[model samples]
Every structure is written in structure tokens, then in C-alpha cells.
Target: MNARVLVAYGTKNGSTAEIADVIADALKEAGLRSETRPAAAARDVTEYDAVVLGGALYAGRWHRDAVRFARRHEHSLAERPVWLFSSGPLDASAGERDIPPVPSAARAATLLDAREHVTFGGRLEEGARGFIARMIVKQGRGGDFRDMERIRAWARGIAKEISKAGPASPT
Candidate 1:
């Protein structure tokens, strides 16, 4: 039986999309079959054995499409093993202290019985933003804050959990 994982993400400047791809690569290295796609592009959750949903956090909240995807597919996701992640907070100096308050995505994920939720640092590029986004980026922030080692470790952990859960049942 093959383990199929769906990595769905919402990106603004494409940072989250890159993160999703990296996660899918890690899952593949862990011996699991995974596909990465935009949240809006994914049509059905029932086809996958496992789901990994990620979003770019703006003002401490996940993208709207991601939230809707979880809410719309809550029933199907609840029955299958799920994981959630958010990308934001470029201030590495804050460490764990920079963790945002309970994001709506996390709350919804909990209600849907997600196995794990994580907050990964995000990136912002210079000149790749509107006035406000650029202002936020100019505060000596706006760099690739993604921790690949941590990301790979988390993927490995998820792979282990999925391996233990075996394959999903055909409906």
C-alpha cells in the first residue's frame, strides 16, 4: 500500500509555495509519495491518505483560501490524518516568543483533529511588495527565514506517524 500525502499551500509572494515544495521533497525522501499544489487548486481531499496544509501568514492570520479549504473539507479531513503549518514572523530574534496568538487556522485544525501544527518563519523580498508590505519588509526584516533542518525533521516525524497509521481506506 502506498502512502499518499497532499501538500497544499497558500502563498502571497510565493514563499509559502516554495516551502510546500520543499516539504513535498522531504516527504519523498522519507519514502512517502507526496504532491504539492496550491490550496485553491486542490479539488478533493478524500483521494489522499494524508494531508499537509500550509499557508502564508499575514497580520498573524493564514490566507483566506487555506481557512476555507479546511472548513469546507472538515469532515473528510477529520477522518484522515492531517497536519497544519503556517509561514510568518521573520523576526528570528524573538525565537519562540514571536509565536502569534492562536491563529484561526490552528483553531480550525484543532477542531478538525489535526495530528500536528507548526509555525515556520516566513520571508519577504525587497521591492516585491506594496507600500505597507514594503514598510514591514524595510524594518531590517524580509529575508528567507525558513529553517530547512527543522522542516526536514518535521517531515520525517510526519512520515513516521503516517507509516504507523498505515494506508487510508478506499471509500
Candidate 2:
């Protein structure tokens, strides 16, 4: 049985989108069928056997659309196997050990029965910034700090869980 995984993301400078794609590819490579799409563009979660929700974090919060998506579909999502991920904390100077901590958004989602939630490092494009974002970047901070190895391992774990469970209709 093929597990249908929906990898949805909300991005500003496209970093989160790229992460979503990576996750989708990993899922596919692990023998699951996956689709990556923006949160706003997602049709419905009912058709998917598992859902991986992701979004870029800004100012210690998840992108608004992602939060809204989760709220709107909380009931439906609670009925299935769900996971969440975030792209934030571009400061890699902390190495892999001192990346502050996972913010409340990721934590709250985990409390909602998410199988897993990861905080991958985010990115900052040179010209892709608003006034506040620009200021943050100008502070000698901000750059892509995504850890692909960790991401791959996380995806592999999710794939294993889904494969073991097989595919099942929600409710």
C-alpha cells in the first residue's frame, strides 16, 4: 500500500518551500508517494494518509498561513498521522548544539500529537527582505543554516513509521 503524504509549507524567501521539496523527495525515495505544495494551495487533507506540515518561522513565530491552516484543519489532522517542521534560526555560529531552542510554535504542534517536529536552519536572501527583515539581516546575522543530514534522518524515520502502519483511511 502506498502512503500518500502531503508536504505543505508556507515560505517567504522560498527556503521553506525548498525544505518541503526535500522532504517530499525523501518520502518518495523511501517508497511513499508525496506531494509538496504551499499551505495556501493545499486542496484538502482528507485524501492524504499522512501529512507533513512545514513553514518558515519569523520573529519567533510560524508564518501566519501555516498557523491558520493548522487551526482550520485541526480536527481532520488530529485523525491522521501528522508531522510538523519549521525553518528558522539562520544563526549557525552556535554550531549544531547551541541553536537556542525550539520555539513555541514547534512545541505547540508537537503537543497536538505530531509524530515529530524539526527546526531546520533558515535562510535570508540579499534582496528578499522587508524593512524589519532587512534590519535583522543587516545585524551581521542571517544566512542559510539548514542541516540536510538531520533533515534526511528525520524523513527516514517518518517514512519508516508510515511504512509500518501501512495506509489507512482516516476515521
Candidate 3:
């Protein structure tokens, strides 16, 4: 049977959720069974063989819900093959080079023993409710910086790694 992977994410303006969907799609294409969920709504990981947790960066900090999810599911997470991602920075920096995880994400990686943590570009557009977000869009400094191809490629790598393991073990 194929391994089931949970692609969970926390997003303020919904862009991060879209990223999670893309990741799940790539995982499925790579022959893994995957599901995408909002970090705050997902309550358990016992059914999944692996997890890919992602969050939106805010002022150098990870989204609060993502941090909470890690805390809530730490034990199950520790037993599973895990990956982390952060999507923020409405610029091309993520595609140009590697960006390290923020403080909270770093802690989650250590606590869960995640196989890897990756940073991806972000998008901020009109209709954002946050003051800073609205201001950035108004100032024309906000745009989609997420690289879809890069995101898919990274997910494929995760699929490859998981495929190399023996049959999926229940956690």
C-alpha cells in the first residue's frame, strides 16, 4: 500500500493553504496518498505515515497555528517521517537561494526530528485584512513569489525518500 502523507498548513490570507494543496497534488502524482488540512483543524496524525507541515512567516515568526499543531501532535509527529516548510516574503529570494527556517520552525524540526525544512516564496495581494498586508499591497510591494515548479520538485523529493522505506508503519 502507498504511504499516506498529511500536508498541513497555516495561512492568514489563504495563500499558504494553496501551497499545501499543490504539495499534496505533487505527492499524489509521485504515488503517495496525501491529504491537505489546515493546521488548526487537524487533530490527529495517527492514521498517516508521514507529515509535511508548513506555515506562513510573519515578522520572522512562524504562523501561530503551525506552532500549536506541532505542540499538540508532538508525540505522533516524532514517530513519523516529517518535513517542514515556510512560505512568506513576497519576493524572489526563496527561489534564488536557500532560506533557513524561522525560530519556531527550527524548534519544531528538532522536536519532531523532521527529515527536512524548506522555505518557499509567498504571495500577498489585495483584500488582505492585516494592516501591514494591506499597506504592502497598496504600496505595490506585494505579489506572488511562490515558485510552483520548485514546490513540486521539493515534494517529489519527499515522495522519493518515503518510497525508499519499508511498508508504511502505523504511528
Candidate 4:
């Protein structure tokens, strides 16, 4: 059976959600079964063989919903293969170097025994919520800073690892 993976994320302004979708797409292309969801709406982790959790970074903090999700399902997540991601570097630094997760995300990774955590470039186009986002846009600092090809490559690596592990054992 194709291993089912949950690709869940917490996003502001929709960029992180797009990244989650890219990850799910890559997994599917590698002959896995994957589903994408907003972390707030994903109430369980036990039904899936593996999970990819992500959050949008704000002021060096992981998004609140993603944090809560990991906590709520901590034990179940620890029982399965898990990966974490963060998206919210409006600059090219994420592409140029490996960015570390904020404290909360780092804690979650340790708590869940996650295999890896990645930070991806973020986008802040017009219509992003919040006053600071608006100010950044008004100041002409807003643009799609996300590098899609790099994101895809990262997801493919995840797929490769999962595939190498073979199909999930029956629950």
C-alpha cells in the first residue's frame, strides 16, 4: 500500500500553505499518498503513517496553530516519522544558508522526535494581513521571495527518504 502522509501547515498570507502543497505534490509524484491540511483543522495524526508539519515564522516565533497542533498530538507524532518546516524569511538568506527553527519549533522537533526541520524562503505580496505586513508592502519591501525550485527539491528529498524506508507497517 502507498504510505499515507499528512502535510499540514500554519500560514499567514497563504505562503506557507503553498509550501505545504508543494511538499504534498512532491510526495504524490514519488508514488506516495499525501494529504495537505491547515494545522488548525487537522485534528489527528494517528491515521497517517507520517507527517510533515510546518509553520509561518513571525518575530522568531513559530505560528501559534502549528505549535498547538504539535503539542496536542505530541505522543502520536513521536510514534511516527515527522518532519518540520518554517517559512518566513522575506530575504534570500533561507536559500543561501540553512536557517534554524525558532525555539518553539525546535522544541517541537525534539518533542516529536522529528527527523528534520527546514526553513524556506517566504513571500509577502500585497494583501498580506497585519499592520507590519502592510507597512512593509507600502515601503516596497514586499515581493515573492520564495524560491519554488528549492522548495521542490527539499520536498523531493523528503520523498526519497520516505521511499527508502518503504511502505508503512500496518497500524
Ten contiguous residues minimizing lDDT sum, candidate 3: 162-171
Q: Which ten residues in a row have the lowest lDDT in candidate 4?
A: 162-171
lDDT of each: 0.82, 0.80, 0.93, 0.90
- Give every collision pair in model 3: none
- List model 1 lDDT by residue over 66-125, tens digit each: 888888888888878989888877767323544542468767678778887888888888
Number of colliding residue pairs in model 1: 0
Q: After aligning candidate 3 to the native by TM-score, how far in Å is the CA of 147 from where it should be?
A: 0.3
TM-score of 2: 0.89
Q: If scored against the real structure, what TM-score would every candidate get?
A: 0.91, 0.89, 0.97, 0.95
Candidate 2 Cα deviation (angstroms), residue 58? 0.7
List where candidate 3 sits over 4 angstroms from the true fold: none
42 Cα displacement, candidate 4 (Å): 0.4
lDDT of 2 at 145: 84
27, model 4: CA deviation in Å?
A: 0.5
Tell me the spans in candidate 1 whose CA falls farther than 4 Å from its real position. 93-101
User: Which lDDT value does model 1 have at 124?
Assistant: 86
Pick by TM-score: 2 or 3, better one: 3
Q: Distance (Å) between predicted and true CA of 80, model 1?
A: 0.5
